[model samples]
Target chain A: MEDFSIIKQQDEILREIEERQPMFTPVQDFSSLEVEYASNPPFQAKIPYLQSKYSGFRRTRGDGNCFYRSFIFSLFEQLIQNKSHLSNPDSPYSQIYSAIKQKVLDSGDILNAAGFLPICYEDFIDMISAKLEMIPTTEISQLEDDFKDKIIADTYVMYTRFIVSAFLRLHADEYSGFVEGYPDIVSFCNSEVDPMNRECEQLQIIAMTEAFQIKAEIEYMDRNDRTETTLMSFPFEYTGPDFKIHMLYRPGHYDILYPNRS
Target chain B: MATRTRLLRELKGKTEEFSLNNVGDDLMIWQAIIQGPSDSPYADGKFTIEFRVPENYPFAPPKARFITRIFHPNVHFDTGDICLDVLKSDWSPAWSLEALCRAIVALLSAPNADSPLNCDAGNMIRAGDMRAYNSMARMYTIEFAQERNLN
Candidate 1:
């Protein structure tokens, strides 16, 4: 296989995804996954176990961006669930939101340092700030409604995608060792990390979670993944606090998981 | 907010390449001008551009098009729709309108025919007919975008 380089330019990328994918598809409730998992055998062995653990999991469009999209919605869900705890300075949700806002602002600096097109990063920051400013009026239950508004959800997800891409490229030297056989860290990020529809790998995941510091846990649910150690924590250095999030990972995809002890 | 602040920054930092055409204080809908790059077909041309910002300003790229009609592989002849990546999906708020104007002027000198919004001009260049393309492009620039039209 040839080495990975930045694939199609922007116009081509937009056209490819335009025919089949919507910018943001509304996240339906979790009941739908229960139905699909019950019928599909490949996912059968894990259904009973998964159903016992998660109340519902929304499936992002399998456009190779399932990971980031799932992460945003899952974080949103957690934010709403813990909204009343806002006054607590240690609130995990509040911390993540503020961190996100800072990341949006800092993205400008990163883009400028790297000498990328200014308008591209500038416009994304604008969209990101608009959503961050809407927090006071955004109710917890209406979180799904916000997600339903394609514009609102797309804006937030685009913000996350942009930050993750910029973070990897800007700090290329620091994360270079993570991906082997790439031309260089900058090129690796341009092709792998920056572009939309590119799937997230271990290195990308680590950089993203660490940059934002939103502690995360992944419970693997694959055919070969049935051991007590299936679930794992990111950052590999977690003495500060346990993860506020619990996600179920199935090879290429990830979704939120809520344990149903009841 | 980002777009509004950015327009003000551009207004304050006006350069010789492009100047804001509107003084009405409507930041959302802006008019601007760019002098065609030297030694290019568009040289001596004064092109007007319309900058339209959506309510979602920086989130979505501000839509920009040439109000001046000219012949170029990267720019559409009739609508003056420019085929610039920064103006499209690659657009991020990191850019100010001033930067966009500079890039547009740069596009005047170097037209990438690989992906053409104006196939006629694009095909002429793609066929490796630089002599024909330059003359035709010059024709459009002189006829539609000239010094006489400058405000």
Candidate 2:
């Protein structure tokens, strides 16, 4: 009875928030964030440093799916914006896109090996592959519109979550040591990575980046009094190509960040 | 499109243990008939469950409740609502309608008395009265979960 009522309350609150906000808001300047934190001195102090590095950011709804949602949207936006290079077979962007697309398709084996039925995840794989195939020919606005469609956006996020869960489950020995409260990696993935609206933590982020073979940089922009926000790369010691996805992380939420051109 | 495909696939995978069907030709509403586990007191019974697929299918768990009443600790006696973690917080995109029905069948044999939706069933189990609990559960199984009742 207590559990039932608590879930009901959560649903009501989530519905109210959903009505007031879109899943993905258009990109906004750093100054807008400054205005939002005017009353908080620590956050205000950190804004100038953020503004110095990042030109702007797109705000994803603060729903627990923010991290994965931001990552997928930002990654697609990067591909869409550079579609000219992506379309040219000779370009490095085109090569990278080909490699990533193949890997995304190949991830189905991982999902299957982890004991998930094809019917359960094949549609998700199809959805992701179709979107990836559209990247070289589609416009950024089209991508934005797709993300605005809740069903489309959630399917992408859900697939991303499954890949991460699959990676962790298959490589349990490597991750079981890091699982804190849960008995093992499988249960940890079940509780944290598998559920919709469950917040993403550091372990899941590591698993997602590794599984997709995509480099990502997350800038920590919290309310703490830090002179500069910390830019942390997944695969912490990554010395490979530049990160393709950049996100601003503030406590429990994440938003896409666009770095200023040098 | 994905939901319909997945449900149609499930409809084709029906077995003697469980069978799935669209309620009134509506894909969003489904009904399943589960054969009781052999080792449990519900051995001779068959249970019917109603599943309401949410808009975000697979990502969100389908809403499931027993349409055939039974005596169980984790299932509400009056409302038939079940209180399983997988149906709530632990659901994954990897799980399908077939998987969920299998879990419900598993739950029938292993009832968690700690968080009971049916107080009578929970109290009987807590009091360590196996004779009383088994008979009551079997009696209800015979009364409401007969194969004819489901049909």
TM-scores, one per candidate: 0.69, 0.94
Candidate 1 on A69-169: residue-level lDDT in tens? 66776666666566665556687656667766777677788766766655455556776577565665667557667665655665566666666766777
- The chain B TM-scores of all candidates, as shown, are 0.90, 0.92
Candidate 2's C-alpha runs over 4 A off are: A87-92, A237-240, B13-17, B146-151
* Candidate 2 lDDT tens digits, B44-138: 89998999998668667899999999999999998899999899878877787888899999999998889899989999999999889899999
Score candidate 2 by DockQ: 0.70
lDDT of each: 0.68, 0.85
For each of the candidates, the C-alpha root-mean-square deviation to the true structure, in angstroms, is 6.3, 2.0
Model 2: per-residue Cα lDDT over A32-97, one tens digit each: 887888997877888888888888888888878998988888778887787888767777567668
Minimum summed lDDT over a 10-residue window in model 2 chain B is located at B9-18
Which predicted model would earn the best DockQ?
Answer: 2
Candidate 1 wrongly placed segments (more than 4 Å): A1-31, A37-39, A59-66, A76-139, A175-204, A219-233, A249-253, A260-262, B1-17, B21-28, B54-57, B92-96
RMSD versus native structure for model 2: 2.0
